[model samples]
Target: MPRRPFSPARNVKTREASQALPPLPLQDASAAIAQSKYFLPGEDLDGLRRRLARTLAAVEAQPQRWEEAFYHALHYAFPGGRIMANAGAESFKANVSTINCTVSRTLDDSMAGIMEAAREAALTLKAGCGIGYDFTTLRPQGAHVAGAGATTSGPLPFMDVFDAICRTVSSAGGRRGAQMGCLEISHPDIESFVTAKREAGRLRAFNLSVLVTDAFVQAVLDDTDWPLVFPAFRHEIGAVPTIWRRWPARDALHTVNERGETCCRVYRTLRARALWDLIMRSTYAYSDPGFILIDACNRMNPLWFSEDIRATNPCGEQPLPPHGACLLGSVNLAAFVRKPFTAQAHFDFEHYAKVVRVFARLLDNVCEISGLPLPEQRAEIARKRRHGMGYFGLGSSLTMLGHVYGDTPSLAFTTAVTQTLALENWRAALAIAREKGPAPALREDIELTPRHLAQNPALARDGHKAGERLPARLLHARYAPHLQAIATLDAALIDDLAQVGARYTHATSIAPTGTMAASVGNNASNGIEPSFAHSYVRNMIVPGEKAKRAVRMESYELLAYRALVDANVDAERLPRAFAAAGEIAPQAHIAVQAAAQAWIDSSISKTINVPSDIGFDAFKDLYLHAVAQGLKGCTTFRFNPEVHQGVLVREADLAATTYEFQLADGSRVQLPGDALVEYEGGRYSAANLYDALKEGFYGKL
Candidate 1:
C-alpha cells in the first residue's frame, strides 16, 4: 500500500460551510491559561495551532495544504493537553510523549517482577503518560513467600511504593504525574483496597477502580455467595479445592477451562450483597474506587483475540491491556450548533461528519510520533494503532438546541451524533487502510478456536469454522459484534471493511476534559456530562504552587445564551432546557450514556452527579442501573466537604459550608468556605486554603 497524496479540494466545501460559524471566542481566563500552558515561548494560540497542524500534516504528501486544513480543524476539534504541549515541540528540547494513556506490562508475583514494573512506571510517568496497573496478581496478605521465608505484606504496600514514585517524579511539561490502580473483585485484599483511599493522604496520586465481572454482578442480583480466590500454583493444585475461572495471567501450569478460564483456589466466601453494600457505602462517602465492567469491556474489544484488559487509564475512559497505550482528542459539539438557543437551532451533521473524517486521519498520524517511553508500550501501540477521538460539550450542545440533557429528544440527538461519528470514523478507517495499510494486528494470521466461538457465537453464525486460519481483519469486520451496529446504516461499508480493514483497532473514547474544556472549549460541559453548575470556581493545579488556585468560570452554554439571546439574563433564573448536573435525575444520566455507548467503540468517562442528601439505597442502585444500561463503567460524585473537595465547586455549596482554620498558636479561626483570607501576602479562599493545608501542599508554595 502507498501513502495517499494530500488534497484539500474535497475539504474546501467543508471549510466554507464551517466558515459561517467561526470558533467561539476564548474568554479572558481561557486565553491566559492557553497562553501560559499550551503556547510555546513567543507563540500565541494561533501560532500554536499552526505548529501542531504542520507537525500532524507531515504524514500527507502535500503537507502545506493539509496543514491548513488541520489548522482549521483545531478550532473545532483539538488533541489532548499532552499532544497540544508536545506535538512538534522538539525545538524546545523537551523529551516527552504526545500519548495520554498507557498500562503497565503484566506484573509477575515476585519481588523482581514488582521492582521491574515500578521502574518502568517511573520512566513512563516521567515521559508524561498516565499509566494503569492491576494489583491482583500478587498473593494475599499473610500468604507465605517461600523465597523470603516470611509472610508477604500484600499489594497495598506495593501501591504505596508506586504512589511515592508518582509524587517524586514531575511529569514532563510540568504536569502532575497521573496513575490508575485497579484490583479484582475476587482478590482477597479487595476490602483493604476499597477502604485505603478513605485513610486520607494515602495513594493520592492514583485513581482506584474494581475490575468487576459479569458473574459477580449476577451473584449480587441472585443473592448468592461470592468466593474470593487466587490462582493455584502447580505445587498447591492438588492440595487446594480449585474452581475454573477466566484469569488475567496465561501461565502454563494453570488448568484451563473450555472457555479459556484458569483454575483458581478459593480463599474465602462472602455474601455477595454484603460486599456490594461495602463498595457502595465507601463510594457514597468518599467517591473513590470506581468499578469497571471487565467482562463487557473484553467482550466488546475489537482486538479481543489478542489482549485482555484489566484496568483503565486514570480517568477510566481508555481500558487498555498490559503495555497498551492510546492518544486522545475530542470534537467540540458546542461549535456545531447553528443559531443556538433559537427555534431554528440545529446541529450540522454534514459538517460534523467532515471534521470527524479529518480528525480520524490526524489522530492516526499521532501514532507515528507517540514517543512512548517503554519498548513494550511502543510495540503494543504500533501493533494496534489505537486512539480515542470523542466529543466534548454534549450537555452544552443539547441545551443550545433547546433540549434538556437526558430527555427523550436529547437521547435521540445523542444517538444520532454518536452513530454518525462512528460511521464516518470507520469510513475514514477503510480509506486510510487502503492508502497506508491496516494496523499490524489486523493483518496478522489468527486461528478460530472454540474459545472464540464461545466468546462470540456470531463467528460461527457467519460461517467461520473452528481450527481455520483467517486474517484478523475478517474476524473483526465480519464477526466482531460492535461493527454490526452500523451494518444496516451502510451494508456495503461493512462488507468493504471485511476486505480492507481499518487503520486503527479502536477509534472512540470520551474523556473528562476538565482543563481542556475550561481553557480551549470556553468552559463547555466536560465530556458527556451536564454543566456542574452555571457559575462555579475551578481549583487549578499550578506548577510550583503549594495549593491549587481558584478560578471563577461559567458554563459555555450559559455564556452563549447571555451573549446571543439575552445579555441581562439572571444566572439563577434560567430557561426550562437548562439543567445542571445536580438537577438531572440519575437515571437520565445512565440513559444518555447507554445511548452513546451503543455507537462508541471504546468506553466513556462520565460521572453521574447526585445530590448530597440522596438516600443511601438509591445511591447504591445507580450502579446496578448503570450495569443494566450496559455501560462499561460507572462513577458518581456526592460532595462531602469533610472528606474532600473537587476541582469544580459551586459558589452556593461553598457559601453554605464552613471551614475551621487553626493557627500555629492553637487558636482556631472559623470562616465560611467562600470567604477570602489573606496569608503571607497572598489571598486565598478559606476552602482552598483549608484543603491546601490539610492535603499538605501549602508549605510547598
Candidate 2:
C-alpha cells in the first residue's frame, strides 16, 4: 500500500457549524498540536504520522519492510505521547529523551547533596522528562539536621523547592512539569505527608504515594503498634547540624542505627490501624496520596540484583531505581476487535501480537535515539534498554466483545489478553537480541559465590542467563499453564519464546495516557479503565487559550455501539453491558486492574474511583484487598470541591446537584456556586468579590 498524503483535516467545522460540536480526533489533534510535539513546523497530522513512521523505519536493517510494519502499527494503535511528540520530530537528534518517566539519583541528607539531587531533577525536567524522588532518606521534622546546626523542617519543606522547580520549568515550557513524591509509611513525617494535599494549593506539582512495606501491612492487619524511626546521626558537618545515618530502601527495615550508648533516642510509636485510618480518611477526602507495596515492587523486580527501586514516575505505573527511565507505548486494542457484539466478536490476537513485536523493535531504536539529559540516565537506559509496550482501548475492546468490564469472563479474558501481550513482547525482545545483539547490560552467566547463594537461593544456579530474557524455567512454571488454559490463541507463542533470550529487562506497563488518550484514542477509556461517564461535558483548559469551553464527546464504547448500528447490526445498549467510571463499583475497577496486572511486568496506572457515600472502613479495606491480590499499587479519586478540582466531570451529575461542588485539581476558585448567606453582615457572592476587586475596594497586601 502507498503512503497516505499529508493533509491536516478540518472536520473542525465551518463558520456555520463552528458553534456546533467538533470531532473527537480533531480535539485530540488540537491538544497534541498545542505543543510542537506531534505536529512540527509545516507538518500536518498525516505528515506527523508519516515522519514518525519514517524515523522508526530507519532503524531496520532492511528498512522497507519494517517501515511498512511500523506505519501499520500506528494506524492500528498509537505510540506513547512522548514517542508521538518527540520521535521523528525536529528534535529527533536533540538531547531530549522519548522516555516519559524516570527516578532521580538518591539524595544525600547533607545540604550540598540535597541541592545536587534537586539540580539533577531540574536538569531532567528541563529536558521534559518527569521525575520521582524518595524523600524518606531525609530525617523527621524537629530531628537534628546533622550538619546544618538546625532542627529539621522535614521532607515536606524541601519538597517545596522541587515543587518550585517544577512550576518554573512547567511555566517556561508551557507544559507543566510532572513529578512523584514518595515516603515510606514508617517515616516519622508520614502524617504530614498524607495530609499535605489537604492544605489547599500545597505541593501542586506532585503526585504523592506512600511506600508501604509488607511489615507495615502485617502490622495494620494485626492491629499492632509500629515504630516511626530514623537512623541516628553519624557526626557533625563543619559547624552545621549533625548528619544522620541513611539506609537503602532494601535495608531500611532491618538496619538499626546502633552507634554506641551516647548516640541514642527513642523512635515514636503509633498504632498501625490509627495510621492506616489517617491514610484512608485523607485519601477518601482527597485523591492526592496513593499507596505502593514497596516490598512487592522490589521482590518482583527482575533487576533487583543490580538496583533498588525507591520511587515511581508521576503516574504509579513505572517504579524505577535511581536514574531509571520509563520509555512506553501501547497497541490500540479497539482497532483489532472484529465482528463486534456477536459470537464472532473475537480479538485479532495474531495481528495484536505482530504490532506488539513491531513496537518492541521500535522502542529498541528509541533507546539509541533518546538523548537522555543526564549521563547517568543515558547510561542506565543504554545498559538495561528498559521499555514499556502495553496497550490501550481495553475497555472499548471488552465492551465491543459483548463482555462486562469486571466479570469472571472479563477477568479470564483480561488475563489471557495480557498473557498473550507479555508472551509476544517477550518473543519480540528475544528476536531482537538474536538479530541486533542484546542490550549492553544483558547479564551474562557469572558464578555466584557461596555467600551469594546462601543469601538469595533463587540465584543459586551459577548466575543469571546471558541476555535479559525471563528464563525458560520461569516461563514454563509461571506462564505456560495459564496461557494454555486460554484455548483462544496458540500455546506455541510461549513455548517458542521460552527458548529465546530478551533485549530489554522490563517490557509491559499500563499508563494513565493523560491528554494523549483523548487526543489519539478517540477518547477511549484510558489504560485498562472504563470511561468516566457515558458522554459528559469535558471542560478543556488549554494553556493561554480561552477557558470555560465544553465539549460532549462519546465514550469509546458508545462509539463502538454507534459503529455497530451504522453497520446495520443491533448491539447491546449503554448502561446494560457498558459501564462508565463512576457507574462501576470500586471493587470491580480493582478487579480489572488486578486481572490486567498478571502479565504487566511493571505496574498498572489505574484509579479506583469511589463514590462519596462509600464507607471509610470499606475504603481502607480496598488497599488490603489489593495487597491480598499481590497488586503493585492503588490510587483513588473522589469528588471534593473544598480540595483541588478535577478536569473531567459528568453532565448529568451537575444537573442532579443543588450546591455545585467543582472537582478540585488546584485551579478552582475558592468560592461557592450559590450565595447561601451573608458574610460580615453583608450580602456576598464570588461575583460581588470580583466586582469589589475590579473597583479597587480592598487595600493591597
lDDT of 2 by residue, 1-701 (tens): 12122111211112121211223344443344334345566766567668778887786778888777777777766676767777866544455557788998887776887899999988898877889999988878998654568898989999999988887786767456899999988788999999997765578789999999888999998999977766654342232322233345322222333431122123688899999899988999988689999878876665554557889999988989999987888877777777655544678788777888887887778887776789999999988888877777888777767677788877887887888787777777768877876555544432333422443454435454334334333432223323333224544644543444457877888888756666666677777877776566554434443222344556665665454333232222343456667767788888888888777778889888788678888888888898888798999988664453355665444443334323347554344422332444434333333322332322210
Number of the top-ranking candidate, with TM-score as the measure: 1
Cα deviation at 645, candidate 1, in Å, is: 0.6
| Separate clash counts for every candidate | 0, 16
lDDT of 1 by residue, 555-628 (tens): 89878866655567677767767778988999999999999999988899988889989999999999999999
TM-score of 1: 0.95
lDDT of 2: 0.69
TM-score of each: 0.95, 0.82
Residue 495 miss distance in model 1 (angstroms): 0.7
List all candidate RMSDs to the true structure: 6.6, 9.1
Number of the top-ranking candidate, with lDDT as the measure: 1
Q: lDDT per prediction? A: 0.86, 0.69
